[model samples]
Target: IMEYKRGSTLRRGQWTAFVFLLMIVHQCVGDIRYSITEEIKRGSVVGRFSQDLGIDVKTLSTRRPRIEFEGNTRYCDINQKTGDLIVNERMDREELCGQRPSCALLFDFFLENPLELHRVTLEIQDVNDNFPTFPNEVIKLEISESAIKGERFSIDEALDTDTGVNSVQGYTLSANEHFTLSVHTSADTGKYAEIVLEHELDREKQDELSLILTAYDGGKPQKSGTVVIQVRVLDANDNVPVFTQSIYKVSVPENATLGTAVVTVSASDADEGANGELTYEFSHISIKTKNTFSLDPKSGEIKIKTMIDFEDTSSFELRVKAKDGAGQAASCKVIVDVADINDNAPVILIKSLKSPLPENSPAGTEVALIYVQDRDSESNSKVRCSIEQNTYFKLSPSIKKHISLITAVELDRETQSEYNITLIATDEGYPPLSSFQTITLIVSDVNDNQPVFDEQSYSAYVTENNKPGSSLCYVTARDRDWRQNGTVVYSLLASDVDGDPLKNLFLLDSKTGVINLAGPIDYEEQPIYELRVLAKDGAGLVSYTKVLIDITDVNDNAPVILIKTLTNPIPENVAPRALWPWR
Candidate 1:
């Protein structure tokens, strides 16, 4: 075991230096490989990244080794504390690789500082976590009493997700005198099981035969699955119904109405009376095909029973069986090729939605996740999702069939607090079908705007010697924000007019923004009063304005006449003496 120092031990300055060096030179050093079993517990050590790359623990830590892989799922990570590759998430081999014989996770192991990149491949080994499965629990087989020995009839095969020895190796049949098991292996189809008749089936002695068929995989404590085989023995009726053709092919539009006949299959029997009268039904057809088409027993006409979607299934292979009165039957294949139709409209499904988005959210912030689907074939199923042009929100393409709704610009609750985001999805079909879905998003308010007065400054006149507590004038302010954030309150900011506090002379109503005279005013003393008022919102945002009040003068005093030193009497005496001197 090799011990390596953790990446956390590296100094912050070293990491910064490494990042700076990485920008100068980046190179691929080569590749490394490892083998591990799937479904290991998270945090299980996989391999030493530093040891495998021939780098010292200190160097690895300084470089900050990181793993980069495809897709969103992170299966492994380099432990910073241990310099070891650890399982980040439990992986299922079957789901990761499906039926592929070899499963490997390929990722790039990058180191900063010196800037070296290495390709790391981890081969995941199977652990037989899943058991073999049969398509159904019961399989019904019809056999005629006149059938000869050694005749083989195909049976359903068991499926195992695990490959190689861990897969379904062989099948076993219950001991029976009438039937035996035959296994066949082919490169194209793999292995399949069949029932072989060892002896002729007798309808009188045994009308029904129940047998067990078990399939097992070659593993330690092997896993197995079983299906009950029910063989129904039929009475002797030699003549079998023969179809007009062994294979019939037809094309029907996906938009064809229900009960529209596609084709009529005719079959005839040479036997007379009860043996010649035949009935028709679907045989060995998939559930989807059977549900889409129905067969008329008497007319042998195949008609659409349910709506067919060309996108889900482009074509269907149906086996039609014609059985005579005595249980003799013949089957023919009907291939129905569904024609394309631009009938399905695109559909939008919301995966995640975040409402009450903050007004201060930056551009490109994800608001919602959406998925679009169209149930039509080929070009008709190709869909494009979009929102209104020049909107605050736009649809961004994400993973397949997924779209992200992100803000194109910052939001402001004062401008538009609530948004009805309409998303439209359209297919690429001729005369394309489109559909729309609307998402309502509300913008949450923030303390972004300060209270603003109706006018920058206000002035009101008050008479001199006015009574106390008189309503001088009202100050109105408005805030654009909503709820408590926009609630405005008024106050007279502390200020001095000739060393007198404005609050002592004037009063402000906090809720209504009303200014009133707190005390008596005299124009002879203080002719004009300059007031500064402040408006504040509940969120603590404040604004200020000026208010000037000029007091109007009234006739409050009487005028007094003053006598100058003997001027009035001297004027009258001079006028009389001037007259006497002239005489």
Candidate 2:
């Protein structure tokens, strides 16, 4: 079963159990491979991805199927809604794989939520888009008129970039009486043609020979290339130079310096004097070999002319020819193998990335797909990947040389919104080479925090009989979340004070949280008013705070006067006592 667990949950294990059943089909059926021809139209469906994986269509939103390429170029993409894997860009088999026999593009199909990976091999079939071509338009050779029958001369091979049957298969020589063609095939170097002398050459009768050599490929259209072979017959000389060895094998490090001696060739001639004396030169070598190495005609010494890089060309094969003063020649092949060195540093490629991740995302959420590449061979290319000093995120080994960056712990956007994660890759070479790539991760906010008031309760004093619609007191609240989730608004909760709604008596500003008097109040009617103010965030998370308003009395009532007794008649009658009753 393939499973990635950050913390612990039965849902994850259940998903793993589900995928484990699919793994049976995946392993038994081998890799999820698809074949498509070169230059396929973009958006063309390659295969049904989710159906092949036995994944449910309803869960595609959370699964988030995606494609991750091994190289920088992205050729295919997955459709989450339809479950179809479609071509993202046009592809050229010749441009992508060159002359490789099996042109397969290897990549991975990544599914999120449970974070499962399925390896996919996309085979790009070749097309007969190119014709067989020769390096040169004309091949020139010299031969002695006395050369006998059955003598063979080497011909430069034609090249075809297409692989398999589309490559050069055969050669045709224009009808000739003096010479015929002999085709040879090698496991290392494909097919090559040679010229064989069927009849003895006479310089007096024929001074020069011009023949046409045509090369054909096995393509459906059967395209071919043609070149002219010019043979110059010279006066007879009996001596023929022969090499000590037919083939020479040599090995040198790719870091070998220029002027480094690779090999030497020696030949002997049976004839004496001018006919026996021989000179050497390179013959029938490709442009790459000619530019890299040089040969000395006098000493017959071959030396490096330019630095050799194993990454570019691991080995080279060139032909060396020795000719006597009579123009009789013989040639041998020298194969130089270049050894590898740990010179290339590991490279980090981010195939797919999910940044600005929602802070509320689960622990096992896959953040990115990373791949490391080292151009060196064998142990030098083996690499170890890691994340530097990170606890919230960790690297999980995936399909060969690929790493999945996943959340190790739950994240809180309020604490840290941004993280700079550094990924380091180190190879297993003797003097280990290393490289690092830093990724910037952003944590998006969620409505996890509720609005909080500045104080638990508030107290304000207001005079009785104050003007209606006057400012009473202001209450403030703050939310920790960002953007719309952090926005807070205020309202007076519905409650009855003396069987009347508090909102009817007090007004709370939705934006500013300012409380205003809705109606007139008197100390005799209500001296103190108790109300609850509620704060809510944009996501509807709420908090409540109590507000107490004290009303002070004012001099608004006039003093009352009461006449206990009638003093008009008693004032005239009484003088000293002044205690007069009207009765």
Candidate 3:
């Protein structure tokens, strides 16, 4: 027989047994049956029974019935619900009666089976074992130098393995006076938190610093872990320098020597060290001479490197530079004044006067003086004079410092009123330089003596029958002056010596000095006539002379005649005498 246990109601170490009895006089036994009250537990066995008396017995179920019987032929019956057994035949033990009775036998057995056949159940339990970790393992952040305080920056997420309420809950940061940290939810997933910065860092004060972050969970007893963060600060340039004034002015003597200090300049910077350091330089300019100037590279002091003379150069202007070590620089202008020094000599351009002088001019006349000028400073600008050549003229000898009248000369118009003269002018410089000028003089003439005629006595003749107003001869006078001054006029001064004015009457032409008969002349009363003549200039300066005239007769009248009557008286007488004779 086999036994089994079920659920919590079954007990351990429990079993049930079955028995079979045989009857000798059995014609055909009615069906026998027995009952066992237990279900088949997992890993248990089922019992078997048979109906053939001479065949073996076997257990079977109508639901699972593919089993056979073997061994003893005696047959028995079984109950499937209770697992009980019963027999129907009896027989001897050995050869049908050899040893013992077979009808009174009992048997027991054990079974082994699979646990799956029993329908077993199991349950699992939970525990907190893992910590939270960052997804990236290492994180980095960047920011500009211009970022101000309270500026914010983003943080990466942390991870954990525990589920639900036991996972990563919140985050915290190490205490930092300069900075603050916070946790924020991820917009993409509510499963992660982001670490954020709430404060700013300054590079000028602190270049770099470190921070710590911790992640916590919602377990009954909270669990957490920390991560390290590094922050770096950057730099910027912002400071500048300035100069106090834009330009500087100074004055120095023109005769200053090389390396002579003229002036100094000053500047300031608000920065320190290399950023604020400064330097200086100069510019090129044109001057009267080969001289130069320079500025100190470090001190910014101005100085002259060559000699200065007012005669060569009078003034100058200088351009200068000022710079810092940072390569940033500025420029300024400087004015330099050079004082005066005496150095130049005087020069004379031209001198001389040439013109005619009237005759008989006075002895103290001023003919001409010299002209000159000097180019120099102060007392050296003064000039003086003298006459190197003074034969034809004389110099006064007292004139000085006056270029126009260095020497005075007198002119004489008598013997030789004309002269060619020369004069010289000199300056007061160390090696006094001199110059010369030349002039010329001329004489003029005046009127004085009266003119005279060449003859004192003269003669001429005319016929007694000639007409009046007829030309005879001309007379002339001479003067040294040319033209009108040298010509003379003539006039009759007196009558003839015959006492009969008509006998010597004559007329004289004033322009030609000619004589002619005034009336008809008779030789019986005056045979000759004489007269006095005068010659003069138009101004009436006079000279006198005499002229003689003579006359001749001609036959022109007839004689008267008377007659006598003698013949007639003779005839008459003869006749009377003859008559007296005849009577």
- What would the TM-score be for candidate 1 when compared with the true structure? 0.54
Poorest stretch of ten by lDDT in candidate 1:
12-21
Best by TM-score: 2
Candidate lDDT values, in order: 0.77, 0.80, 0.48
Candidate 3, residues 313-410, lDDT tens digits: the string is: 45566655555554334556677777644444445432222245444445544344233445454454555544555654554321111122211333
lDDT, model 3: 0.48
Estimated TM-score per prediction? 0.54, 0.76, 0.28
Query: Between the candidate structures 1 and 3, which one is better when assessed by lDDT?
Result: 1
Cα displacement (angstroms), candidate 3, residue 328, comes to 7.5
Clashes of each: 1, 0, 11
Ranking by lDDT: 2, 1, 3
**Which regions of candidate 1 fall more than 4 Å away from where they truly are?**
1-251, 257-307, 311-315, 319-337, 359-365, 388-393, 406-415, 497-500, 552-583
